[model samples]
Target: MKPGSLSHGSSTAWGKALRRPAALQPHLPHVRTPPTPRRAHCPPIRCGQVPKTPFEGFVARPPNSELHLGNAWSLAHACELSYLTQDEVRSIAEGRWGLKGLLCYGYGDNDGPDTQCFAAAGPDFIVVAFRGTTSITDWVRDLKVWKLPDGPLGCEAHAGFLEGVQGKWKGRSIIDSVLQGVRDLERQYGKEEGLAIYVTGHSLGGALATLAAAYMLEDPELRDKVAGHYTFGSPRVAGPRFKKRFEALAPAGRALAHRFQNREDVVSKVPAWWRAYDHVGRWWYLAGDDQVLMRNPDLWTRLRDIIDIDWDFQPDFVYDHQLRAEGTGGYIDGIEKNIVRSA
Candidate 1:
């Protein structure tokens, strides 16, 4: 039987369900409105009963092991925080996550419209999260698919993603600011404390996270300190050379860095493979029915999965890409459930 063939029972039940006529619908263009500012005391959109403490089960030690589901859950929330105003983010960082400080940066002021991201530090970890696509300018950046020789080892990265990380904020590039933040944390806690740095984001932000992590890992001083990078629904950011160089620098031979693709998220598949772009690190496939596959499916299986999308009666690609708060069918929902099942 062919891999992922329905008759062989190799495909998931979720894949089978998608084949039903009712599941077919024309793809709609997604337009996201700006998120309204919320009171600092209220929790962000959640899946279930809210926790008293954020990232409650996160464990930063033993960095050599495979990516932990707890860490994925925590980092997903960190990406969610990037969407909020700086003051709200600071409140969550201090009140919920117990982070000592939050430094939010808005760059591109001198060059173009601003882009925003933040770095939050605590005793055990530092999280640098880039906000995902939420504006017309952000969409323009995402569509700029040209490649440039910007990554390590002569590797080329998506020109827009490279720009996103290299653009200056107060005369310092985003990459430099991230490094300086790590340095400050190291100075405060001392290297003996083993401050683990995690870079994360969603969609366009995810591409930036991968590039930023790659840039930081290239630095000999900060390489050992960076724990990993976690991205969600992120597009491919670089070519094969970048992937090769990144593996050399990553912990556990690329196991530490993971890209989570929930169901049939269309965003993760571009800038098309034919265009010489490829993903870095490991792939965590969040299957259609909430099961998390540690590694991506084989090529044949992946192709079958794509065919299951039914272009004529397409599922909402935009909906699948969302980092939803309600907890049904989003990245956070899938990872949160996986955490419980693993326990």
Candidate 2:
């Protein structure tokens, strides 16, 4: 087995289930509201309750060894995007793909007060990576919820993350730049050439990546080109409506989307999935370095994760949400360590 990765019994049931296609139905019309926030003093972790959203049957595949090389590559790119400089990004990513062209853009103000994404592109694929929150303002952004325009393709998302993508840096929309980068690749490579498009990020970047990919897939042409969607320690992004629409838009089999959650990586469980916010892809959970196994949540298992805040953050939700912890299972350490092992 790969370093730090353990194998379970020879069962590959989870991987097999992922490959099996699921039927899609036309969306049902209904107004959905966000779940009421729970008091923090109470144990946020749902003890034993089944979630309204489908949670059973989805499985977390084993670590590095079981993941597709492409998935690993995508994760590596996402890590580089997490904090590395543009030159550093190019240095690490260019040698792997035999890529010729490189383009990079910084969308938000990075002056230690704002959250932003440093998106980059290569000849065959495009990557949009977001930086985690670094300020009191950013944490506040994470806690506040505004009704996202609801419709056939609408659901509530974290207002701050949405703003980061929708707003502009120097008057340019960050999300637009991401879309344009993929389009440029497609334009150069052409459809018949089978250009592979991918989107990835960590923490806030992961959430933004999901939003950008969902929006891009809205176009029929772009949907066909998406090769992978990978995220690490991503908080839940949108409500069930957006998820259903995204499901219909991307579909299974056609889109190879995977969401990775490490042990106790608090961000992955936030903005509760039980609430209107739901995740769109299969989850690859890493249960430390022990044997890897795949199984769905039991009937009594709760889908929504209550983010238990630190005692000191009694009144400040922002600082409570902005706690910093990183290591083997953390956003940066997990990816970087795995990349080193694979290399």
Candidate 3:
């Protein structure tokens, strides 16, 4: 397990999907708001409750794992963009894959951040390594959640997963470091040149990205140093309360928070949404459909000039009360559910 990670975080995310009965339809139409120009607002943040948008990106994508095409594309986009701005790139590349290889993706080759014309001016590069896939040595009974170890498999590799229970994001250390990296960056470089932090992953990587965003926004003192949040294929992070808390915490909570799910993807269906965090919004893609997630109250929040993408946002889209694998579960009861606001 990566250091400072919340163990069973995936289970927590998946809990929402598992405990519910597949019933209601998903709410999406409410997000359909009359187009309006986005405006930035600075609202005071509250703890354990309401969250405010502070223009930060808390990415959970580790650098050392095997990324699917979509995730790689997202990383490439974010890395390229970060390089252009000369912002520091701190990649938590530990876990499943390994840092040494993916770390170069950010700072190596002609396409590396260092080679970019603006790279000299690019974001600082930082990499965090966790109990990645390749590193996991032991396992006992491979359950969907925690892989129980019996002998060698359970003793060595599974140890990390167990340790993760205490860490912020399942016993992974990157969680705290990711936040600290920005806090240090903010202390060193005031949000002048602009910082672009991108957190992404393939499957499990996507889940990590969500938690990282939540953990970063857990405190409001350092919201200003965030950048873009681009998750390739992620499941849900918090529950309805978590979402509510996030919405109350940040106005632009859902800004640039993109969850890219592929056609008939499996992991994408694991961390289904429930009442865990009531603040964040879920964006579902139906290929032919425009955008499955929409509720316009915070539509104006995405245009800010910050560099990071924080979780804890308000949304217009919702799945069935139960995590359903098929059909559009519980959707909008009223247009307001998709477009509610603070008067």
Candidate 4:
């Protein structure tokens, strides 16, 4: 056959193939639900060490939020780049954060930090913070005080959050925990030059992740220390002013590593658009903020239920992933590397 003739035939074939039936088309791999006999736990979560999956050098524990593949991938990347190294990073456990709620991402818990699952190393962090939350510290000797769920990624809350919350829907325990975690990191790896203070979380935990970053940015000293953040399915926390406010105080490049997901994802849609705190002015000062369409995250995945029962459920994590990969997470990490690479 002539070269031009062959080319023409290929083009024609491509066009014809485009008309194939929808069922006959190929689709991207999808995450299937756990089999009928799911993890016996109420809201199943998996926590464990990802030692072989490209994260050999780091130690990790799944925060019981949701041990998602994407979150795990991002966690490995962050640790490798020195953006967020696993250490004696500490976190407080919530009353099994995700399993009992529908809006698991909502900030609605607090109580004298009931337990300290010090990761001398363990899965005490929000294995999920909802994706297998882990720590970088081992100061404590035993896990006796730990209240880990059945899965490896179980997490009630991390150490840095605000105290005396729960009822107020104002969570800062996660905040304080992070601050302390940073101090711990400084104590342990301070001599390790080029070290960065980074925070990451997926879904409900993403909200906490942002909250933690915000607190760190509030302090010039702390902000300068942190390198960046990587979040997946993070909801819209605060408003436009948050970016500016954090930048002014921290000076350090702020990055929100964000990734969105389609199914069983309620985090991105949390802090519902209708919340008064959606704006910067409110979020920074308001006491108790509520929103329309908000549901109890204690029972199930709100967004997923909505999609599965109320609307067409063809959701995509691509947009959420793009928002972070190309925007904040990637851009800020680049800047940090340029500046802190040799520091």
Per-residue lDDT over 105-219 for candidate 4, one digit per residue giving the tens place of the 0 to 100 score? 2222234332121111112111223221122111121122222222111223222222211213234543355455555545554543423444665433344455566666665
lDDT of 2 by residue, 80-178 (tens): 344545565566556543443455666223423244454444444555555544334555667755546632245666676787677665566767766
How many residue pairs in model 4 have overlapping backbones? Answer: 77
3 or 4: which has the higher lDDT? 4
Candidate 3 local lDDT, 160-279, one digit each (tens): 222232133223343454555555544553345444444543233344444455555565654433343444334444345444544343344234344444323344554333322111
Per-candidate clash tally: 0, 0, 101, 77
lDDT of each: 0.67, 0.49, 0.30, 0.31
Per-residue lDDT of candidate 1, residues 1-343 (tens digit):
1111123232433344222111132333332222222111211122343233556645665436367666777888888777666677788888778887677777323443346678877667778888776554566778889988766556888888888878786677867887787777767765576777888998788998888888778787778878878899999998888888887776543355788886668889899999988898777776544434436555543444445544335354545676662322567776776555444
lDDT of 4: 0.31
lDDT head-to-head 1 vs 4, winner: 1
Could you estimate the TM-score for every candidate?
Answer: 0.78, 0.62, 0.39, 0.38
Q: Which has the greatest TM-score?
A: 1
Q: In model 3, how many backbone clashes occur?
A: 101
TM-score of candidate 1 versus the correct structure, residues matched by position: 0.78
Rank by lDDT, highest first.
1, 2, 4, 3
Better of 2 and 3 by TM-score: 2
Off by over 4 Å in 3: 1-172, 188-196, 252-256, 272-279, 282-343
Identify the superior model by TM-score, candidate 2 or candidate 4.
Answer: 2
